[model samples]
Target: MDKAKVLETRRLLAFIAVFEEGSFTAAAARMGMAQPALSIAISKLEAQLGTPLLIREPRGVKATAAGLLLSQRAYEIIGLIESTVEEVATVEQHPTGEVAIGLPSSTAAVLAIPLVERLAKTYPGIRLRLVESFSGYLWDWLLNGHIDIAVVFNQASRPEIISTPFAWEKMHLIGKALPGEANAPIEAGQLTGLPMVMPSRKQSFRDTIEHHIQKQGGTLDVQIEIDAGHQLIKLICSGRFYSILSPGSVAHEISTGQLQARPLAQPLERAICLAQRRLRHQATAVRCVTDELLSEARALIVAGVWDARIEAPLCT
Candidate 1:
């Protein structure tokens, strides 16, 4: 057989395993092969490809620069192969499969807890993988086929993804109730020059807030720009700095007296949107799970689980 033809799928898979597990011995155990046999196979693969794929280190083996590049391509190849197998198997079996959900860290903090629990109970066969990232990264991942779906705030310029409104929530200015400060609504301009902790400029919420401030003839003096919702809430509670967030995120803290939430004057609100790739194929189970999410979200809205002002935008 030709040398290239001798490079079997099994060898490629073994190479990938070693690249991931970082050791020939561990890869052998993972692949159910003797350590020496796995090492021989790796050697054969490197010889066939005419390149060293891994770098031996004292702690563990690391992929070489070439190896790292190959590993990325290997991942995509493996994913496509697995997806094909799963599609064929689904035709014979039921629509049970995995769904990878990408969410912003803030959305995951507020919504994923209950959503995951419900999904686990209702669809035990459907494996759900949640990736928490910022809106930009999540959007990129969604387009790149790294995730199956996402729940995020709608962006002004829509990407080439199919999106549906999942829920709506009012944005609130949360801060420690300062000594003797009136418990009344405060104007957005009043927050100007305050040492507020805000989300990074890339986040949709921060962009909207900044636009609103500028439109009202004021500028925000952001002392901190954090991406993690829990961290922001903790900072607010610790009296270090104040931040703005959707009411849904800070509801628990507000109810428990850990933090105080006030509606911004001339309030802003945004819709939570569910997004999936426009051209990618979605497994039936994933679609069903999304449907369940929408149903539960609607039920939460009806039961007043979300705050009252979150129903629609205060502006329109």
Candidate 2:
């Protein structure tokens, strides 16, 4: 590349840092340069463009209208450069790197083990790191680039994220059954006064459940709040409280007859989403592990182990 072109690219990066941070000192520190040097670079950039890109203010600086347009274009240019470099580096690659994935506790309970096994067997060079939390945390991690991939529930629209529908799981009423009692579907109205063990308010699925119940003129009498899915299930199994969960969440207990699950008369379902950062470059290792995850989920759904309907086919 030409020397002038290289300097222009550097100036663009400097402008982006200052524009986002809104402070020359912070942007200078972020770029590992002296504050004076960063300011001079920005001045030179403005002079070259024949316009003022930013206005100095008491707090720091604010972008001019022209500056905003340049910042947006700069991001596109930088993103394209980064993705191009990563793609070229992966040519003839054996995918030897770590890929971090986030999953909600409910999905991780069943999907984690199989995903690990498949990756180890098929792509030994690819190391897998799993972070388990609720869907809300998982969404944050995915957007902030803390994780390469995530399995979330009913993800909302966001420009930074690219999510695909994985499945739709039907919610059920789960609790310990009385002796000689037959498990039957429960009416939505019947949950009005049910003493339920529920997830914390921060959890997205908790809001989904609340919305459904409230829509039916029912309110949950929550006796306990537990964030961890496994612990919540344990509390429910003690025969002290009931919870609304998907069959997949309590598949083991349901199979062993330790806990019985009753479907709702009017089905309530939640979407399982596979999410990733929209602008981040997808490396070979990341793509390989994502494929393995999709395959494992498909196999589980097909074998009737996870009681969910596939919303879309796996990505190739």
Candidate 3:
């Protein structure tokens, strides 16, 4: 079988939809196709690959390991194709292209607005798509061709992910106002006793926090684990539990006087970077977006819009 025929976009998308929806009937409904047609597509794909991807259960269906792997890669494949088409259609003067950027919630809160505003004014023809996720997933998306660029707190040790230093972000311990000491810096040793909520271990930031605590002869007293950034910010605003985060993640709450934050006595810092896929054809639109992100972020820092410090190699 020809390799090109083996990985048809339609079939890959169909299989991924089924894998996500967990049933051909449901996937087909979501995709606006007949259930039998969806099933046939999946079967044809399996035949071409010479492997069974679906394990039909009593109630619905589940993807086998192979199916899951393909589903993950399929996202990248489809995204790359879309980006390539858009890039080719884009012009230099009237650069009309779409750039997909994955940013952590912290960075997204601070950079997304300014970046969008700048791009809108500078290159109105360019379209921007912002995705917020933990650093680990962002790294994977960058590697797998799911995103054009990423502004991440921590980068993965992948040679294929080209990174340029963006800035140094200071982490904070945020929650209810302390008893008569609202401005007091929270000590690392004391953090082991505070009830906290943070991202799950799947997120690289959580591990970074834990590693910092352990190095300081303490540990995170995490009461709950959640991966969503908005929920974590909501928890900080609730004041019921304390969480380690950057001020940028909850800038609205902090600015509105709805929340209070203090830097750790032993400040925890993470280096943020602008990462792109190495050895891949990078679109000019993508480069323009990346440049805009750095510029906006630096301006925000200098203007105190974001409580982060700009590090070396600030531009490009």
Candidate 4:
């Protein structure tokens, strides 16, 4: 048999319908065709294949052995075709199927929580996945297609990725001061001799802090180097060490007295940027997530909930 002649789509459909409905009359009604026409179509289909396709009884019909074999193959083919149609339609409508985002751990905790919640509520079907890593790792993942977008520091060197400033946060010192020192405003040099829990120097914020310290002719007395914001907060609250972070990460802690946030006399600010691979088209889901993150960031800035001075930067 010619493979092309044997694989008639309409014949396979007709055959399956009859097999499923158990009679030509029933199949015809389901298919919106007359019983005689449906029977004729089935007869012609079986004759073309040179096989007895059905066993007729008084009340209904059953597939002959050849009919049973063809039925299985027909189902597989029909399923694939239907799946292909759905996939094509989905691609046409959304263009991007799903989006994965890489975010800094601190940013995910302080900024991404509400954005993700809003996304779940508003666009439930748009598949969104997040991987929380440090800035360096997140940057690598974004460029490698492990993630579609990244929320990261503006200072990261990624000429290959398109970076846009989405938000800005001022860095601040967080600590549990000794008696009477909590309310006293301390100079940048005052932090020199204190035991400090600081982020790894590889972090952009660490560089900013170090720059400010040197400008003030002071040095950071590093007792611990922890990268995660919550861990830094916990260490500070335990009165074991003092750490520096963007005010956004510790605002709630300061407000609740779990920690105290003080402005550094020397201003240190970091821009937060949304990045995607350069020249790569973004999906609807990625765009939606980025928009929501910016919205939440603005709200936090306005409400002073994050305890930071927020600035919007102009991108050239």
Full candidate order by TM-score, most accurate first? 2, 3, 1, 4
* Global fold similarity of model 3 (TM-score): 0.69
lDDT of each: 0.71, 0.81, 0.79, 0.72
Residue-wise lDDT of candidate 3 within 1-316, one digit each (tens)? 5787799998987987777667788889878999988989999999998999999997889888888778657766766786677666753357666778898887788778788888899989788888988877887787666887887766643434667766887888887664336778777787777889988888777887898888988888889998888888888778788888888888888888988888877777888888876423255677678778888889999999998788553353
Give Cα distance to truth, residue 4, candidate 2, Å: 13
> What TM-score quantifies how close candidate 2 is to the native fold?
0.78
> Candidates 1 and 2: which is better by TM-score?
2
TM-score of 1: 0.66
Preferred candidate (lDDT higher): 1 or 3: 3
- Give the alpha carbon lDDT tens digit for every residue of 155-182 in model 1: 4323235677656776777777742254
Pick out the ten consecutive residues of candidate 3 with the lowest summed lDDT: 277-286
> Can you write out model 2's per-residue Cα lDDT over 1-316, one digit (the tens) per residue?
4534633778988998898678999899889999999999999999888889999999999999898777766766666665567668766766677788998888887788888888899998888889998888888777656898899988864534568887889898898863223667677788877789988888777887888888887788998988888899998899988999888888888999889888876778888988875444355676788788888998999899888888653455
Scored against the true structure, residue 86 in model 2 reaches a CA lDDT of: 65
TM-score per candidate, in order?
0.66, 0.78, 0.69, 0.65
Each candidate structure's count of clashing pairs: 0, 0, 0, 0
Alpha-carbon error at 124 in model 4, in Å?
A: 0.6
lDDT of 2 at 186: 76
Error of 4 at 152 (Å): 1.0
